[model samples]
Target: MATEELNAIEIEIARNRLSSIAEEVGSALIRTAYSPNIKDRRDCSAGLYAPDGTLISQAEHIPLHLGLMPTMIANAIAEYGAENIREGDVLMTNNPYIGGSHLPDVCVISPLFYDGELIALVATMAHHVDVGGIAPGSMATHATEIFQEGIRIPTMRLFAAGQIQSEVLALLMMNIRTAEKTRGDLIAQVSANRLGLRRIHELVDDWGVDGFHRACDSLLSYSERRTRAAITKLPDGTGTFTDYLEHNGLYAAEIPITATVTVAGDQVTVDLSETADQVDGAVNCSYAVARSCAAYVLKVLADPTLPSNAGLTRPIEVITRPGSLVHAEFPAPVAHGNTQTSQRVVDTIFGAFNEFTEHLVPAASSGSMSIVTIGGIDPKNGTYYSYVETYGGGQGANPDGPGASATHTHMSNTKNTPCEVIEREYPLRVERYEIVRNSGGSGLYRGGEGLRRSLTLTRGKATVVAGTSRVATRPWGLNGGGDGGPARVEARTNGEVRELESMGSLQVGVDGTVTIQTAGGGGYGEPEAGR
Candidate 1:
């Protein structure tokens, strides 16, 4: 039967099944992964795509990684001609210039076949702890160029014809600092794709191949219809808002990210042309990252219940200046771009969207990922170490109630490194982990509060590099609400305590303590009656 012949019930079933398959792939990778970053924090995403690289369904994962897979798949197919890719061949890449958010995020792509015909692509993007850069964690805060951030892997086959490429594995292992962990995570990704392929075959067996494809197409069209309907309800006008990054890693000057949202009939355009130019730091992001951020805001503001696919991005257009902070050129460092700038982009978009309709959008969120990278040697085990993580912050308040506290939001959805896992795996001790009272903004429905976590090194000395935002400016509240508290970081070494800048590098001696307090979310409505 033709794709248009698929009924609504049949299309919904098929669409949900495809999403389940993507969820299964993510579950398998998280269960068998080696690093805490993947297994504990779950910094990964899985999705299924059409042969032409149109997104079909994606597991509920990191927003930054979700929207970039289609582009990456197209790049992979371009590098290795479509005719060269086989059923069992798997391609991998982490080059930001080639549809990637950053260097540490390695993407794996596997093509699926049914009855000797190419049907779909199973892909996943996972954040590895290390990818062999100047810094131990591969997230150098002061890096001036992309090369200094980490090794850049171009589109290439890691597995061919159902067999692992030994030389390719060796080269990858040789470059990264954590060879064993990286290898295990890569294997986990491969396993996840294979599992997805097996599940797809089962799905095809249940519903004929043609029926399955038709259902996918129907689902895409349905989502597009729902999104357009939602868009038509908004007023036809322009809403503009600007957000600032605390500073790029190389300087103390504030960086601006502006968004102008135009709603005309049933379409919206997010223009970022007036934003700051690319800086000489590690916070510059690719156009892909900018698109992901804008797409996320539109998806949330629109019908979020609609299945996420290419359809959600159909009515939205994201335009960025070629050499702006949100669309950096080649050789620019982007280690912190995926984590830092992406959050600001989300805030800027939402700020603009709120002007169009006050009740539709929530208050500003924490507006930063609060990335901390530590690397050193363990004196007892003599093992080189690199630890990368981001702390959780508060969520923005809605019209109905207060926001949630100590959680991930927007472009970043990574879980915090559990104290037990950190103490067991690394030479560090979690001295204190608790919520900071009154950090949330004061309003009728107050925003969520941030958290405080202190860590002490127990082994050899280590170098710590951190990139954070919301220090110079607080998270903005909506309507008559109050702004949220800003984030802060400090280090206490050898009885001398000093506050650290938003982005900087420092040395932590054995027994030195580092404390970080994440930012709170913005409030909504007027202040409450008392306190």
Candidate 2:
């Protein structure tokens, strides 16, 4: 009898197993990483790809990072030439123009070979605390060019032919403020990919190389079919919406992120060609980011149980113009683009989709990552230290119930750094850590509340960079609901208190205090009469 073809049960099992491999890769990266950004906050992603550079499966990690990996793999393969990628060779990159979201996020890809034939690739992307730029954390707010953001890595062999490239390694560590930490995290990424490669070998052995490839192809097609069916459920029409960034770091001007979502039959197109031009600040985003946000919105709106892969992207078409905020070109500073601007893109798409699915979509969420980076020497230990963390804000209110309070949503899903960890790791103290009550918008379903966090310098001067949003414009509510509170940043030095811009840098002298009050989510629906 001929071997049976793949059935629904077999396809489902293959999908789960593939996703399990990706999840294990993520777990290894977190447990072995050096920086709190990766270990504690969990700002990293892992995925498995077919030899032809298609996304097979990914761990449920940062949405922005996960959505951008397929292109990164394709670019890497093109630059290195598929025939040249041998066993034990790993490629790396973080240049936004070269299929990356930003500089701090580094992508590592390792090819898997079975019976002298390349079968698959395992990839991982992590946010290193430092990569050597104008700032200690490499996330400078006012940098006008990508060079100032950090060292841009092209598609090159980080590890060639089973040998670690020491020159490449030294060149990377030489530029960043936290060399040891960066090096440690990079090594952890390599190890994570190696672990994933080992698992892939085991899987291929169990199913045979041909059988494994067949399973991947079948699952990818299944995901596409499911996504197309979900799109057909929406009313065929056009929905347009626009959201704004309070300001890019260089100037105080409203930057618009607009999207016109058109759903025709079983296809969806998100047109972002109407967004503002690229600004002379670190707020510019790349094409990958725009595509990622658009795909993310559809993923959330579609079936909740849809398995994530390249197939999920098949039914969606994303349109963006070059030199625009959503699809910036080379050398455009985009440190804030990945974190701050990406959030607004998601909100804009959701806003447009809400026109047709009001009950399904939530009100606006905290439209920023509220990123803060602090670095200096620890006077007590005489060792250098750099800390980068993104604070949690309000999540949008949904029809099902109230929004989640003090949480990271959408493109970013990092956990808050524990107050105790902050103090123990660096020369600082958490002065205040509490929820800002009444910050969320009011309606039948209340939005989530933001957080109030204050940090005091215990000793030694430190440089502080704040890249936040939702200051001038507040999170929007829906159907007669009230808007949420605005974001605020302030500094108090030597008995003098002054307000701060949403995007800027400052020096925190000893005993000086910096406070950040994040924005809340938007409420959903009109308030009911009486109690």
**What CA RMSD would you report for each candidate?**
1.3, 1.6
Cα error of candidate 2 at position 519, Å: 0.5
How big is the RMSD of model 2?
1.6
lDDT leader: 2
lDDT of 2 by residue, 394-485 (tens): 88888888889999989998888899999988888999999999999998999999998999999999999887888888999987777888
| TM-score of model 2 (CA atoms) | 0.98
What TM-score would each prediction reach against the true structure?
0.98, 0.98
Write one digit per residue (lDDT tens) for candidate 1, span 189-242.
999999999998898898788877887788888888888888897777899998
State the C-alpha lDDT per candidate: 0.87, 0.89
True lDDT of residue 228, candidate 2: 95
* Runs off by more than 4 Å, candidate 2: 1-5
Cα lDDT of candidate 2 equals 0.89
Give the Å shift of residue 139 in candidate 2.
Answer: 0.9
Ten-residue region with minimum lDDT total, candidate 2: 1-10
Off by over 4 Å in 1: none
